[model samples]
Target: MRRAISVGRDQLMSVGVCFGKFTKSGKFKLHITALDYLAQYAKFKLWIKPNGEMQFLYGNHIAKAHVGRISEDVPEHQGIVIFSMADVPLGFGVTARSTVDIRKLQPTDIVVFHQADVGEYLREQDTLF
Candidate 1:
């Protein structure tokens, strides 16, 4: 039996539980507790369209065309946060391309913070208990 750790809305993007953490790399995945804490704050994030969002939630690799927007500071290797078009934190990803290169990126190019990969490990954990 594991308790769901609760964090404030202000802390959602910046907070992590025992399950994950955000270091020099971008943010890790949000626990079920904070995934809903969308709105207000926005930084180090990338917004993907519904198609991308579904694959992201389904745990598929992200592509450039799938990304609609991104934070200004997202650099190569930086752990950028993943978000749904609705502003929910979908997961984590590492930038394969820098902000400058993103403008000319191809649809098949990858993006950052792919932890837990869609909703596998996280989803699996919930169903087990």
Candidate 2:
């Protein structure tokens, strides 16, 4: 099943794969994707700091804006995507952008933003038995 997330007036910078309570790390692996808002493509990986901040690993980059949170549900082994409001075209491929504090997130609470690129990908690809 496919789900849509409303980013609202604020733009998002990166998508996060929150492994809520399932892993000991207590952190999410934020990822950047190849598709632009207009559907153009590029490639690269970016890493996220421990404090939920974003940085680039191998190319010139733009700073991310801090947006308020929106809630959505993610199934097992699922993730969410974040989009940049400022129109900073991201490099292609999935990148680890940063981590988030998952302490207060309940199993039902939307721990990860459910509209990110990686989240959408996971929802589309079925598991091969």
| Candidate maximizing TM-score | 1
Backbone collision count in every prediction?
10, 12
lDDT, candidate 1, at 94: 68
Clashes of 1: 10
The window of 10 residues in a row where model 2 has the poorest summed lDDT is 56-65
- Model 2 off-target regions past 4 Å? 1-33, 37-53, 56-67, 85-129
TM-scores, all models, native as reference: 0.62, 0.22
Superposing all C-alpha atoms, what RMSD in Å does each candidate have to the true structure? Answer: 8.5, 17.2
Lowest lDDT 10-residue stretch of candidate 1: 31-40
- Tell me how candidate 2 scores on lDDT: 0.31
Error of 2 at 63 (Å): 17
* Tens digit of per-residue lDDT, candidate 2, span 44-111: 22222322223222222222222223223323233223333333432222211322423334333323
Best by lDDT: 1
